[model samples]
Target: MDPVRTGGLRVVRAAVVLCVRAAPGTVALSFVMMFVGGVTPVGLAWSTKLLLDGITAGDPAGRNAGVAGLVVLGVLTALLSHVRRYCDQELSRRVKVRTQIELFTAVSAYQGLAEIEDSAFHDRLRIARDASEFAPVQIMSSLLTLASSVITLAGFGYTLLRASPWLAGLVLLSALPTLRAQIRLARRHGEMIVRASPFWRRQAFYAALLLDPRAAKEIRLFGLAGNLRTRMAREIHAGQAEERAQDRETLRVDLGLAAMTSVLSGAALAYLAARIAAGHGTAGDLVVLIAALAATQTALTSAVLDVATTGELITTFGHYIDLTSRARPQPRPVAELAALTGEIAFHDVWFRYAPGQEWVLRGLDLVIPRGRSVALVGENGAGKSTIVKLLCGFYAPVRGRITWDGVDLADIEPLELRRRIRATFQDFMTYELSAADNIEVGDIGGGRGRADLAAAADWAGIGETLAGLPRGYDTLLSRTFSDSAGDGGHEPTPGVVLSGGQWQRLALARAVLRTSADLLILDEPSSGLDVRAEHEIHRRLSELRRGRTSLLISHRLNTVRDADTIVVLRDGVVAERGDHAALMAAGGVYAGLFRLQAAGFADETVPR
Candidate 1:
């Protein structure tokens, strides 16, 4: 099929399917109502002609019956109009909810993190989301409106043809220009929206920064609010300026079309008046001719506009289809992953986030032995977090392989592989959920009980802090909502926000909750804590790491001093590897960083 026809079929199929699934009875009834409503205008016009002829012929009974018929048709049309409006509103609501669910499901089904990291993907995803929000309703509405307008136009077209074929042809031809203009405008509008999506997203981000509580402190401290707001306003103005330019073109086209339509209607009206004045046509014929001409023009305009609008909606809906239909890499069929037994090894690994980008991990060889704590120490941009992502199966190496025991990671299902590993990253999310719920999310498959929750909290040294909250484990951990608001609506209560250290401890507690995982990775887990808190956390972590394979990534050298093995990374390659004592004795990159940090602490202790 032609691509345009294929896309149009897809849009129509989706609209029909959604309408029927959302509210089948309402959709059927809406069609009936709109059909009746469409034909009623011609019926009323004919009745009016009859009434005028009855008066002219001086027949009281004929006039009375015509009057009654016209009144009945008008009332029926109004009734159908109201019922159809109600049905459309209900259909729109249902379609909106259903589309949102499908869109979210499609987004969640994506298996790789690479697309999420790409700005172009973000732009497309944002447009898909926006399109899904209203495209279903717009498509259904436009389709139905087109159907009704076509019916109305056909009915009035026949009446005008019988009165004067020339006038009817002129009216039809005038609609051609309007239709062409509307279609062009619709294409331009869609293109502009796609081009402006990134700017709109940036504007939203800046606006969010002004409102975000986390950014509020920094924004005020640095006096960045004014600058950020100005940038946001500038983006909005730029977007508006683009829209205004499009609107100007649209205005010019519409005005020109309107002039043509006015000329056609005026010529039709003058011809009708001349026929009636010369006794060539009855006043009733003039009335009927005038009504048909006016209705034909109106219906043609509406049908053409509906076609243009539907075309635009179909184009937008194409984005949603494209996103949901994207091919994801299929995980190979393989045996279920077995529990880790010996070690996890990276052999000559080389990887980057995208093709042509600089390698984030290059020819890296490392081993994380079973039942041992291994620490990775590195400077910024040393691929520390990238290693964690690779280990967790978020990305596959562009070259080389990672293996658990003797089994290649590439052969293991990503989901199955993830089932045996857990990690907390430097940029861990603080979910706006209850304290217990946040911790529970870590090991949802484990069926963690109250004892397990408490044990995890205690291990992370956050039990005391959680116990003092307004609702203990059930306390809302975010200020986004009131405490009682999310707890089944018992009563409203103010939510409390945790301190930075407290939030980090909660994150640690979340990781600790996943007790069954064979490998536990902590990437800068204690970075947010104070000196005393960091010491206590590492001490607790040391106890937790006793017989489990774990990887620790941290800048603070002291925290990793007790690790069985320490690997220092530099420029995407392993620079050195040994126990803390051996690395320090070697006086390499690790030793230099340790000495620098030690010097800062030593100066602080000199009675400042």
Candidate 2:
């Protein structure tokens, strides 16, 4: 089989499965209704012919029965039409919900962060997610529509053949040109949509920026609103121009097909009228022939259109399959990791984000001993955060190994390894959730209790501030959502937004909630705090660090002065090692940086 055809079949099969699994009863009923509706037109046409013949024969009883049958078929078709519409809508809703859940689950299953960071992956993900929302429903609807059209076409074609085989054949052949045109148009439209996806994504990004409260200050201060809006409009116009070209071509083809169809139908009707005038066929025969010819044209047109639409839908659905089928990172060994009782050492590790990129960590060797505070100090781009990412198992070393108690980290599952450590990043997220939910996410399994949540908040020095809120622990930490106090009323309360310093404290509280984690890592934990607030938070952190293995990364020399060990990194290599006093005595890079910072606060006397 051709690869494209095989892939399309797979997508169709998957869509069928989704529909059946989502709502089997509704799907079954929809098919039955479609069949009834499809065969009803033939029955109505024959009944009308019988009624006309019976009236001409002067048989009053037979004419009344035919009239009653026509009325019943008309009512039945109307009822089936309404019922089928309802079933289609309900089935679409169910399938959309199920497919979206499955797509997101596949995305979250990826353990490596590299794929998520890639721009190409984001584009594919956008296509996959959008396809999942509508493709399944479209495929099923097209299939049902096709089935109905096929039944109607076969029934009408048989009736037309009984009248005149040559006329039936001509009508069928006339539909070919329209079908061909529609198929070509559909292919062109699908290609255009794929080519324009990136532009659409950029337009969405700029539109989001305009609505984001966080960007409002910078956008106004820098006068960037006009520039951003203009860029967004440019992308929209570019996409629209391509679409308009395709639409113009489609309109031209369709108009040509319509003219051909009209000429063929007019010629066929004239021939049938002459046959009736020659007295070879009755008036009843003329009525039946006209009805069958019109019905056949309508049914064949719909079937062809359904085929074209389904082809486009399947093409879009290919993205969903490609994203879900992407190879995941290599699996780690199933062996259990031992407790972190010994030192965690990186043995001559080398790593880079991509193959051609400059090395972020080159032949780096370091040891973080158990039950001791290790401070990593360096300027920007010193591989400080890279080390944290490796330790957390977000990436593996390209050369050498990182070991916990002589056991290589590669031997343990990333999910399992992360369970024993907790860390806060320099760019920690400010989740738009309730205050309690924010902290609970840090230690999801342990922090469900109110007391545990409060204790963690207190340790980060944000407990008092949280208690002062209207809803305390339940207060929403963002202005994005309406807060409902659940007072059994319809009104919603306004949510509270936190300051940068307070959000930093909440992030710290989240990490502190993980009391069971063997290793605690803090990166720039005090960067957002004022001098007095930083001092208080550090005091609490120092008390909590006793007998715990912790890694602290900060540029402030004073904060790491009390650490058990201080390591300075430079250009992807460790440049200095020892406590603050020892490094100061050696007058190395760390010493120079510390002196430069201390000079900022030194008293200077100017002689006039």
Candidate 3:
């Protein structure tokens, strides 16, 4: 089998297994109901003939029994149909939830944290995210319907054979092309969908802008609603057009097939009716044959539809196969990493974001002494943040290994290294969670429970902030789910929002939630704060660094003038390294930027 087809088959089979596993009893119930329901359909067709024969002859003994049998068959079929629907519901619900849980967990485990900047990975993530919803379960249900429909068609054909073998054969032949046409349509539909992936997401983003509180404010301020909607409609139209074109071809093919099936069915009915009129068959037999053939056509059409639909859905999941196959996390050996200390040394380290990209850090050598505060100042895109990521173990060096107290960093376990360190990046996230949960998110292990979050927040300067919230730290940070509608729609209630500086403070607090870490990294920790807040945070940072080593990356030269050591980075290499005064005498990259910043406040204070 071709790879894509094989993958699609595998996905469908896996979904089927999940459906079966979710509610075994329901699966059994569904099978039983379908079998019984099919039997009742056949019985009803036969009973109708018998009832008609007795009525025509006016024989009360046979008439009563035939009428009662017809009624019983009708009631049985209705009850069986109900049971089948209930079972299908149960199976669908369970499979949907379980597939979502697994897909969610799989995406969570997707590796290559360092490759997060890769756009290709983002596209793959998109598929995995869509897969995490209810698609898997829907495909499974479609497949089960296909199977039951096939069984029903077989029963209908068997009943027809008892009346006229030639009629049954002709009906089967006429209906066969319907399945082929549906299969072609499914492939075309799936292809159109995959091609429209980017368009769909873009439409969704523009659509999202109409509803989001923050985006809504700016959009209305700019009077962009009409423009945004107009753009959205264009993309939507393009996608719809692609779909219509695909269906237009299928429509033609299906119409021809449907016409053929109808002609054959009509011809069969006429032939059977003529035979009954010619005294070759009784009226009762004629009615039974007619009903059976009609039911047979319905069952065959249903079977064909289910097969194509389930196949198409399974094909859609193939989009995720490449990403999911390689998404497994890298193994980490922890026992050897437990001996790590804060001493970090980068030796002849070379790095690149991608294979063909320029090296961000080339042949770099640096070190941070244990229990000391140090700063790295560099121009934008000059590999300042890259170094921090390397130290934090988000990425391993392309050429050299980072050492932790002398052991090669790569040899140490990633989890162990991460547990022993924390960092607050310049572009830190402002989580839409409670102020308490926000800070506690820094050290999830310790961030949970009451005492730990409080201690971390108190140390990071979030105590007063939380106390001021409407519901204190328990309040949700989003307005969407906060004021939920009683009927499961939008509640439209707003939640407490925070200032930029306040949010930055909370991010910092979250980062240092685990004070026991051997190393702590602060990258532009005071970026958005006012002078007083900045000074206060610096004071807190200095206090927090006691007995713990730290690396501070900042462009604000004034903040780290008193650092134990200041290194200047330029053009992917360290340009100058020394104490602030020594760097000033050298007048290198760090000194120049520092002096320029000092010139802004020259009259207030001067670095000696």
Give the runs in model 1 whose Cα sits over 4 Å from its true position: 1-6, 59-61, 327-331, 406-408, 486-490, 602-608
**Alpha-carbon RMSD, each predicted model:** 2.8, 2.8, 3.7
Candidate 1 global TM-score = 0.93
Ranking of predictions according to lDDT = 2, 1, 3
Against the reference, the lDDT scores of all candidates come to 0.85, 0.86, 0.76
Instruction: Put down candidate 2 lDDT per residue, 468-528, tens digits, no spaces.
Output: 9988988888787888767756367778999999999999999988777889999999999
Q: Highest lDDT among the candidates is held by which one?
A: 2
Winner of 2 and 3 under lDDT = 2
Candidates 1 and 3 compared: the better one by TM-score is: 1
